[model samples]
Target: MTIFWTIVGIAIFFVGLLISIAWHELGHFATARWFGIKVPEFMVGFGRTIWSVKRGETEYGIKAIPLGGYVRMIGMLPPAPGKTLGRSRRTGPFQGLMDDARAQSRLDVLPEDADRQFWTRSPWKRIVVMFAGPFMNLILAVGLFAVLLMGVGQATDGTRIRDVSECVVPASVAATQEVEQCPVDAPPTPAAGAGLLPGDRVVSFAGRAIEEAQGQQLREAIRVASGPTPIVVDRDGVRVTTSVNIIDNEVQDFQDSTRTVTAGFIGVSLLPDYVRQGPGTVATEIGSMIVRTGEAITKIPERVPAVFGAAFLGEEREPDSPVGVVGVSRIGGEILAQENVPWQQDVSLFLGLLAAVNISLFLLNLLPIPPLDGGQIVPAIWESIKRNTARALGRPDPGPVDAARLLPVAYVFVLVFLGFSLILAIADIVNPVPFFG
Candidate 1:
């Protein structure tokens, strides 16, 4: 059963990842189509096609790898030579015959000089097409976060005390007279060597029902007990009766702004009750999450430099390293194992995390590094500026870019990025600092 559930969880996580990737690529595809660009192929994933079908001029397909997707647009980049014809041999007898036949067969097709080709479109239009993918990813992240916040509501664990040292304890009024030492911790404290297991729920103390107000009274009863006081707890829905000895102690209640006079130390943590939210409350909570996520992203540059410097210098630093697929899968499994978390709630949380990941991917890709969209846009902008200057000087616009000169630089940058990603992936696997942890 555990294995089955783990597999299901992994499958769900992978599906979500793929959907996020597809949504991002869909943005590019849609924008290209809107501009009347010739989209020769629209594909999800990379590598050889696993499934494909031609729809009008576009060949839509799914690839073998689900890591990323793309839409290949005609004239967006240099065109490849025909299967048997080399680029330099475009006018050979055989090539000429084939070209003539191809040209004649497509007599109704739009001429090559048509403005629909991506290169013929204005530079601003091209920029829009390039940026749409990342923009869509950001939109998806915000939407997912909003939905999750609205659906599940937001609550903090009671263990995180809003007011320091202030706590509610249970006691019986009739049995307990003057309080001596109250139980400091409910289940177990580090000092007492007592600990609460996963499924324990407090029932009552000294025959008194454990209510919100009566908790303090119960502490007094425990303090006054001559010997071990009887305590009742429900574990996994089964009632278990036990005795806990209490030690006398004076504790400060910061919330009350006073010291509590009590006895007996029973070490247990306070657990918070969930407060459900209405639609309006949910909207507010979601908005808060979005704001927080945005702020966190903005801090990455500052935080990442410090972290990397610490690692390089071998200095003592917080172990908040990145986690790769292995770590994420482990988290998904653990979340699935947790009891009382509704399926929809779990799905919503998972999707929110996935969206955040996509947002990161989108932002990372926009860095002005070679082989990225930003990198390509940089040169395009420079060329556009040069062309405008030349036009003002009454000179002819520079001829089209020579692809041979750019390919080598792009290839080198891609290799460097791939190498860096591999290093990070290895680091993540060996030294994972989980997000939830």
Candidate 2:
């Protein structure tokens, strides 16, 4: 049953992935058409086309590889100075590469498309057309986050006491065993001695109302009490008042398990609750995710060595290391197959992962490197600046910036990315992250 559900979850992720890709490409295609640029193809994959339908000068299709997608617009590159449009003329070393790129870019430009070519549009329009794809991803990410926060609700530990401990045992002893058994010398837990029952909703402790303060404050109140403290709880529609002797004990720090701290002990466990989060909570969480992702990207140089070790040297994989698509999909399968996990929780986690993926896509596409949307956007912005400056100085309007010159740099980036992807894939298959455990 777990295996079947795992496969189902993977299938669902692929479907969601296809939808996201198509939606992203749709942004480019729609914006390009709006700006009068002739789009030849709108594809949701790479490699040989598996299925396609030609409609109104655009061939919409899915390809064999499901890695990425693109929208092919006519004349993405401008011709070199003194060169005829759609014609390639190589004059020096590596010039052939530039000429071939320009020629290939203009190949789909028909006679009527000469006026509607992408390069023929103003620089601002070009920026909008290129940026629309990533912006679509950002929009989807935000929507997913909103749904997860407001609709599904955030899992939280509430003030209700789920269970009370039988006795108080030393934290140092508990750390070394699966279940710590209280010895004759151990003291009775405060909650147990106070007769606090399960399902009791804590109202106040030491004159501080639980509803008006955070859980940490309540904890601190218990820790600081030198003697018996008054506690109020709601028990089955009735308010129950009691006094519990807050005994000082060495307990494991709630935030850090490795260390122990002297605090007042009341061994009551919190009950689970789903707290509805506001838009501000959603924004804060998303901002934290973005910062963490940026930190991960910046640490890639330092972490790549560990990836190689884990892939080929039988080393343990780091939990916080970067993962490729394969690793993420494996995690998705594990998340779905987790035993005893409710369907709602599984769906929430899966949606969260998908949201993170979309966020990554949004940030990656905006990188100012060629073959990426941002690379073209940078040149368009530069061209806009140059043209405005030339006009202001009474000089001739400069033609569009030749993006073909950066083709070699784009190729290098592609190769490095592919190599890194391969290594990560190998690491994922052999030393998969133990997310299930």
Candidate 3:
């Protein structure tokens, strides 16, 4: 049953991925048509075409590989200097590359497409067309997050006691054991000694009530107390007051396990709680996700060594480390196979994963490197700047910045990206990170 659900989860994620890819290409396709650019193909994948149909001048299709997709727009790059379409007679050091790029850009150029080439459009229109793809991913991410956070709600902990600890032990000792039960020589937990039971709704701790959601006051009071502290609970509709002897215990630091601090301890776990968030909270979460993802993307170069070590050597991969498409899909499968997980929780987690994937897509494609949407955008922006400067200096419009000239750079970008992707893929397969554990 677990295996069946896991396969189902992978299939669901793959379908979601295809939808995301198609949605991204649709952005480019729709905007290119809107700006009068000749779109020759709108494909949902790469490599050998599985199916296709010609509609007007454009061919819509699906391909074998489901990794990525693209829309082929006419004249994506301006012609090479002193070179015309189908009459390329140049072979300088890198001239042939630029010429080939220009030639390929004109592959679907018909007589009417002369005016419909992407380069013929205004720079602003080109920018819009290029920007639309990433924007679609951003829209999908926000919508998913809104549905998960506002509609489904986030799981948290409440003030009610789920379980009372049997023994008092240092966090260092607790970390070494699977279940820290009361030893014959060890003392019982403060909550256990104080006669606190499961299902007790903690009304106040040391005169402090629930400060914020998730029983913040109780946590703070437990951490700060030095000795016996007064606690009030509502047990079975009756208010009960009790005192617990707080013990000085070694607690593990939240960020670093090597570090420890002495704090008050009264061992009791909180009951499961959930709080449905508002638009403001969802927006905040989205902003944080974007910032965190951007930081992670920037750290990719630094992480290559770690990825290499994990893939080649026997080093364990970090839980929060970067993952490729394969890694994320495996994680989706794992999420579905989790033992005893509720259906709603599984769906929520799947939605969250999809949202994260879209967020990553939004950020990665916006990078100012060639072959990506951002690369095309850079040329358009430069063209706009040059045209404005020419108007100011009483010069003629220099025309579209010869994007063909950057063909070599774009090729390099593709190679580097391919190399990085290959490494991540290998690492994902060999040393997959335990995302949840």
Candidate 4:
């Protein structure tokens, strides 16, 4: 049953992936047509076409391999200066490459398409056509985040007490071994002695209001104080006040998960709550995610070797490390197959995962390197500036920037990306990151 659900989850992700790809391509397709550019095909994959339909001037299709998709706009790579369009010679370096590209680019370009070619458009229009794909992903990402935050609610670190411990013991040591309870010599925990009970919501601690203080701030206040301290708890809709002596004890550090520290112990467990968020909170979270993703992108080169080692050498994989599409799909499936949690929780997690993936796609495609959206955007903006400056200086109209020369660079970029993609795929299968952990 678990295996069946896992497979179902994987299938669900692929369907979502296909939708995202189509949405992205639709952005480019729609905008290109709006700007009068000749679009030959709008494909949602990279291999042989398994299904296709001709609609007007464009062929819409689904291909065999579902790794990625593309929007085929005629004259994306303009013809050589003073050279006939799609007429490539069998001489010079990259001549064959240019020939094949020019041939495919203008597959059905008619004589009337001379003005309809993408190169005939002004630089701003071309920039919009190239940037529209990633921008669509960004829009989707924001919408997904808004849904996840407002609809599913956010898991918050509130001041609700889930449980109370009777005796004092180091949580680190307790985790390592199965000790039934604290030893006879152990003292009563502060919360237990102070009559703290399960389901008691902390109203305040050390004269600080929980409404203003949150559970973490109250925790820090408790950890820093000693002697008699006043705490108010809301039990069964009634506010109750109590006093307890905070004592120094060895326990797991709340701030740093991996370390143990000696701090004031209260012996009560915090229960996280799911709270609704407003638009401002959603915006803030989106900004934070963008920053984190940007930092992760910067560290991707450094993390590849670790993934490679984990895949082949049986090395431990860090949960925070980079994950590929396969890893995300596997994790999504595992989330669905989880037996202990509610199905709603699985849906929330999957939505969050999809949101994150869209965010990544948005930023990655914006990278100012060849073959990516930002690559062409940069050249288009530069060409616009050059042309504008030439006109302002009473000079002749500078021709469209010949971007066909970047074919070799784009090839190298694609090859390097393919290599990394292969490595990440293997790592995802061999030493996958644990979703629950």
Candidate 5:
């Protein structure tokens, strides 16, 4: 059963990923068309085409590898200065690469495409076109998070008894054991002594209404109570009054599991329920994820050694370590296969994980390093600044930024990215994140 669900979960993630990639490309395709740039291809994934359809002038298709996708736009790179397309006389170290890039960029350019070139668009419009893809990812992430946090709510302890312990166990023992129970010589806990049972809706602790109590949590009420305490619970649709001696015992601290604090024990576990959160909570969580993801990006190079160790030397993988697409899909499988987990909770977790992935994609594509949307953005911004400077100095329009000159850098970027992808794939299969999820 676990194996079945694991496979199902991985399939779900893979499908979801392809949809995300398609949606990302849609952003670029739509904006480019809005500005009259010729788009020849709108592809999801890479490698050989699995399916395709020609609509209008665009060839929309799915490819074999589900890693990434692209939209082939006409004139993504302007022609070499003082040279026609496909006719540049290469003269320098990187000029051959530039010429090739310019030639490739011109393949979709027809005689009528002179005014429809991507490089001919206003710098601000070009910026928008480049920015749109990642913006879609961000929007999708926010919508997913909103659904999980605000619509579906979050798992939190509620004012109801899920279980009642038969006997009291020391906090240190309870922390280490899979299940805590009484030995033959152990005495019954106060809750058990008072006959508290599962399915009881806790109404009040002492004289305070349970709903009005601090955070509506019974633990805090029990922790501060001493001697005999009155408890009210809604049982079988009727209020049932009871009393128990709130015994002081060492328990795991709420804020930190590593420390123990002396607190009152009643021997009952609160039932967990979905508690709806406000938009503010969603904003805070999104903000935190952004910061964390940004920090992780900065640390990728530093973490490669650790990834290598885990892959080759049987070292343990850190919980917060980097993971590739394969690793993440595997994690989705593990999450669905978790035992004794509610289906709703599982779906929420899976969606949250997907949202985090989207956030990573959003940030990764925004990196100002050619070939990437962010890299394209850099040159557009530079051209914008340059044209503004030229106009102020009464100089001639310098024309479009020759993005082809960046082909050498783009080649290096692709090589490095592919190399990292290879390492990540090896590590994912050999030493995937130890998902004790």
Candidate 6:
């Protein structure tokens, strides 16, 4: 059953990925066609063609690899300056008999014409064609998120609390009638040393029914305990009894005006769980995902350096550092395997993640780095601005860009990006961090 679910999850993930890529490419193809640009080929994936069919002047095909798709349009980028236009002539008797001899001849080359070319289009048209793909991705993400939000209600969980320790105020402060009590570094100091494990919920201490106030009292008792005392805890719904003797320990809880005081100590933490609600929808979920993703992206510059430093220093960083495709698939599989999560809830979560991934892809592609959609758009914008400047100064238009010089730089950048991506892929495969861990 686990294997079956894993396979299903992987299949669904790939399907979503393919849809994203195709939707993005479709935007480009549609826009290019709208502007009368001659699209030579529209294909999903790359490398050797698996299937193909020619329609009108374009060949639509699916390629072997499913990583990405593309729309090959004539005059996509600046053409080579030295390349001459091909001229065709027919001398056979069949040429004079047929008026459309040039069009019929498979061996004949067609001359390049300005009117039918993408380069001859206005700057606005070119911009629209280039921007359409990422724009479509963004739209798709937003739409999915909206659907999710509408299907599922938004609610905060206990995990969202900034500090679990602060949830309960120190009894010492309450005793003193102070508005704010000095924080205590009181450790779990389990009343008994019965080998209590981490994540064991303190259901009661000394049989006092451990509510918030009772738990605080237990902590105070442990702080003053000089001898072994009994402890009781709940581990995943199983009751466990333990005992611990408090040893003299000094720790700082909060840094305030003057001094730090010593408090009881234990080394266990409470695990937090999400409080589920049913007011979520596709739209709302997508929106929430977008907002969270944007916030995450904004913090990257501040966070990446710290992450790298911790990794270098061999610090125990959180297991949920960064996840790639493998991590996502594993999480998807886990979600599918869990019996408690309802089918609609599972679908909502999957769609929400899909929206987030698509949004990230859209933003990444819009970065003005080499070999990206934005990279190409930058030059086009510059060209337009330069032409406008020349016109204002009463000069002739500066001619097309030198594609030769830029193409090499673009190629090198693409190679570097691919290498970096390969490294990430390896990391993802070897150490897939589970999302729900």
Which candidate number would show the highest lDDT if scored against the true structure?
5
Q: Which structure is stronger by lDDT: 3 or 4?
A: 3
Off by over 4 Å in 3: 1-5, 51-57, 84-91, 154-156, 160-169, 174-214, 223-249, 253-258, 262-267, 339-349
Task: Give the 10-residue window scoring lowest on summed lDDT in candidate 6.
Answer: 155-164
User: TM-score of each candidate?
Assistant: 0.60, 0.81, 0.83, 0.80, 0.87, 0.61
Taking every candidate in turn, the Cα RMSD to the unseen true structure, in Å, is 11.0, 4.2, 3.8, 4.4, 3.2, 12.0
Which of the numbered candidates is closest to the native, going by highest TM-score? 5
- lDDT for model 5, on a 0 to 1 scale? 0.85
Give the alpha carbon lDDT tens digit for every residue of 1-437 in model 1.
Answer: 76777677767777777777778878888998898887778888878889999999888888986656887766654232333432333454354444443344233236763556666666667778878887888778766665665555444342211111223333342124643455556433321333334345556776776753344455455556644566676666687777655555544343452345555555454444333456676455446655665576566555554444443544333444444454555556655655544455466557666766776667755766545666555656766777888899999987443232354566677676455445444444444444443
> Between 4 and 6, whose TM-score is larger?
4
Q: Pick the winner on lDDT between candidates 1 and 3.
A: 3
The TM-score that candidate 6 achieves is 0.61
lDDT (Cα, tens digit) per residue for candidate 5, span 133-168? 998998888989999989888887677777788888
Our model 5 lands, by Cα RMSD against the true structure, at 3.2
Which is the winner by TM-score between candidate 2 and candidate 3?
A: 3
Residue 397 displacement (Å), model 3: 2.9
Task: Sort every candidate by TM-score, greatest first.
Answer: 5, 3, 2, 4, 6, 1
lDDT of 3 by residue, 1-437 (tens): 98997888878788899999999999999999998888889999889999999999889999997778999988887765555555456666787777766777777788866999888899999999999999999999999989988888877656888778898777878776766456788789999999999988898888777632547567767888978889998899998999999998888764677888888889887764557899998899899999999998999889888988988897889987788878888888888988644455787889999999999999999998888899999999999999999999999988778887777888898788778778888998999998875
Summarize candidate 4's per-residue lDDT along 20-111 as a digit string, tens digits: 87888888998999998888899998889999999898899999977779988877777666555555543678876776776776665688
Query: Scored by CA lDDT, what does every candidate get?
Result: 0.58, 0.84, 0.85, 0.84, 0.85, 0.61
- For model 1, the local distance difference test gives 0.58
lDDT of 6: 0.61
The residue ranges of model 1 lying beyond 4 angstroms of the native Cα positions read 78-114, 158-319, 325-330, 339-345, 387-406, 423-437
Residue-pair clashes per prediction, in order, are 29, 0, 0, 0, 0, 38
- Please say which candidate is ahead in TM-score: 1 or 6: 6
Alpha carbon deviation, residue 145, candidate 6 (Å)? 0.6
